[model samples]
Target: MTDFWDDEQELKKNLMNVSSTIESTVATAHGFIRPILLDHVQSVGKMLRPALILITSALGEQEVTEDAIRVGSILELIHLASLVHDDIIDSAAKRRGKSTVFAKVGAKQAVLAGDFLLAKALMLTSGKERGMDSRVVSRALSRLCESELEQDAGQGDFFISHHTYLRRIAGKTASLFALSCYAGVALQESEPTRQMLCHRIGYCMGMAFQIQDDILDYAGSSSKLGKHTGNDLKCGIPTLPLIYALKQERENGQTQLHDLLYQASTPLKEKTVKQALILVESLGGVQKAQILAESYKKRAFSDIKRLAHPQVERQLSTLFTKLSTRSV
Candidate 1:
C-alpha cells in the first residue's frame, strides 16, 4: 500500500482555512468567556481536533462538500477549553511554543475561560437538536474531564503499571478523537455502521497517536519534539513505554529506575533521558509500544474500509500513517 503519512500534504493546505478559523476562535476565546478569562492562557492553537473532525466528516463526501467545518469548529472549541484547564492543572508554561494562559493570566482566569469555552462547545454540539448528539457529546466530554482528574491524582510513578497509563491517556485524548469522528458520522447522515466504525477506528488511532507522542518525547530531538522532549516525565507522567519497561525490570531494578526517573522529573536531562531510553529499548519497551501503535493503525485502516469512495478513504488512510509517525 502507498504510504499515507506523506499524503497529508494536500489535506494540510485544504484544512489551512479551517485552522485559520480555529486561530481566530482561540484569539477571541477569552472574549465570550467569563471575566476570569485572560490573555496569558488564550491564543490561537493548532486546530488538531477540528482538522480531525473535518477530515472524518469528509469520509463519505467529495472534497469539503459536507458540513464538516461546523463539526470541526464545535470540536475545536471543546479542545481549546480542555487545554486551557489542563495547562492550569499541569502547571504548564508553554503550549505549541507559546505561553499557556494559566501561566500568564493566572489560574482563576484561565480556568474560567476553560469553563466558558466548554459551555459554548455544549451549545455548538447541540446544534438544532438536543437529543442523541447532545448526550453523546456530553458523555464524551465528561469522560474526558474525568480522565484528566484521574491523571492529576495519579502518583506519576515511573514504575506505574501499564494498564492505568493507557487508560488515562486514552480517556483524556482518545475520547475526544472518538467523539469527533462520531459527530462527523452523526451530522453527515452517514450509516450507523460507518458511524460505529469511525468512533472505534478514531479511538484506536488516537491511542496510537498518544503513545507515539510519549515515545518521541524520549526518542526524538529537542527541536523536533518541540517543548521539552520528556515533558511527560516532567509532568510526572509515566507513559505506556516507560511503565512497561519498568514492569519488565526486577523489583530492585524497578526501584532504581523509578528513583532515577522521579529524581530527574519530566523533560528529564538529556544524559539521564538517554540512559532511560537505552534501558527501555533494551527491554523491548519501545518495540512493544510501536507494535501497539501499529495495531491501532491497522484497525484504523479497517475502519476506513467501511466508508465509500477511494479518494476520501485514501486520505484518511494517509492521515493515520502520518499521525503515527509525525515528529511532534
Candidate 2:
C-alpha cells in the first residue's frame, strides 16, 4: 500500500492543523465535561473525514482555510458521537483496543455522552465563525439519525434487502463524508458543479470504506481488528458478506445455511457465528463483497479523474488505493 503521509506531505501537515484544532476546541471544556468529550478524541482511529476535507480542498488547488478546519473538527466530533452511540447499540466491549465508553460507563451514561458530543458539534457548526451554511449540516445529522433508526428497525431479521442495506449505509456513513468534502470545497470554490463532484467522490469513498469494514468483520482476526471477529453476526446485524452468502445459498437450493442462521436461534451463539463465517467464505461471500467494494472505488476514481488539477487527482487516486486495501 502507498504511504499516505510520505506521498502527500502537505495534506498531512494540514491534517495536523485539524488535529490541533480538535484538541484545543475540546480543551475549552471543564471538569467532568472534558474527560467525557476527550476520551475518544484523545485516542482517535484514522482521521479520514478531516483528511477528506483537506484533500478535496487541495483538489481545487486551494490551501486549507480556517473554515475548512472548523467544519472538519465539527464533522469529526459528530463521527465520534456516532461511534459512541453505535457501540452502545452493538454492546461493544472494546474499540481500538481500549474499553469503550459503553463498556466502562454503561449504556445510559454512554448515550448521554454521545448526545453531549452531538450538541457540541451542533453549536460549533451553527456559530457565526463557521462561515458555511448550517442547513447542510442539519440535514446530514437528520439523515444520520434516520439511518441509525432504520438499522435498529432491521435488526434480528437476518435477511435484509440490498436496497435497504444501501440506503442504511448511505445515511449512516456516507452522508458525513459527502458533507465534509462539499463543505471543504464550499469554503474554497464557488462553482456549484465542482462542489457536487466532490460530494459524489466522498460519497463513493465512504460507501467503499464501510463495505471494506463489513468484509473485515468476517475475514479479519481479533488482533488485527482490535475487537472480536464476527461481532456483527453475534449482534444479529446482516452486512454485505452475510447478505451475499445468504443469496447464494438460496440460489443453490441449500437450506442448511439458512437454517443455521435464522432458524437456529436468536442473537447467534459464538459457535453459530463461526459456522456462518465458514459458510460465507465457502460460498464466496468474501470475494463477492470485495468485488462490490472495488466497484465503489472505481466510482470514486471516476470523479477524482475529473478534477482539473492533475497532481491533486493523482494524489487522491493514490490515497483511495491505500484506503481500499487497509486492514483496519
Candidate 2 residue-wise lDDT at 77: 87
**How many clashes in each candidate?**
7, 0
Candidate 1 lDDT over 1-328, as tens digits, reads: 1122244665555455555544455455535343334342234434556656766665553444335665676677777788888888778887767777787678887787677776665654435631126677777878888888988777455666677778887788998888877766666667777777778877987888888887886676776544776666666767877876777666435565656775775545777766777777777677778888888788888878867757658766776776777776
TM-score list, all predictions? 0.81, 0.93
lDDT of 2 at 306: 86
Worst 10 residues of 2 by lDDT: 125-134
The predictions' CA RMSDs to the true structure, in order, are 4.6, 2.4
For candidate 2, what is the TM-score? Answer: 0.93
Where is model 2 more than 4 Å wrong at Cα?
A: 1-6, 30-33, 59-64, 126-135, 264-266
Which pairs clash (backbone N, Cα, C closer than 3 Å) in model 2?
A: none
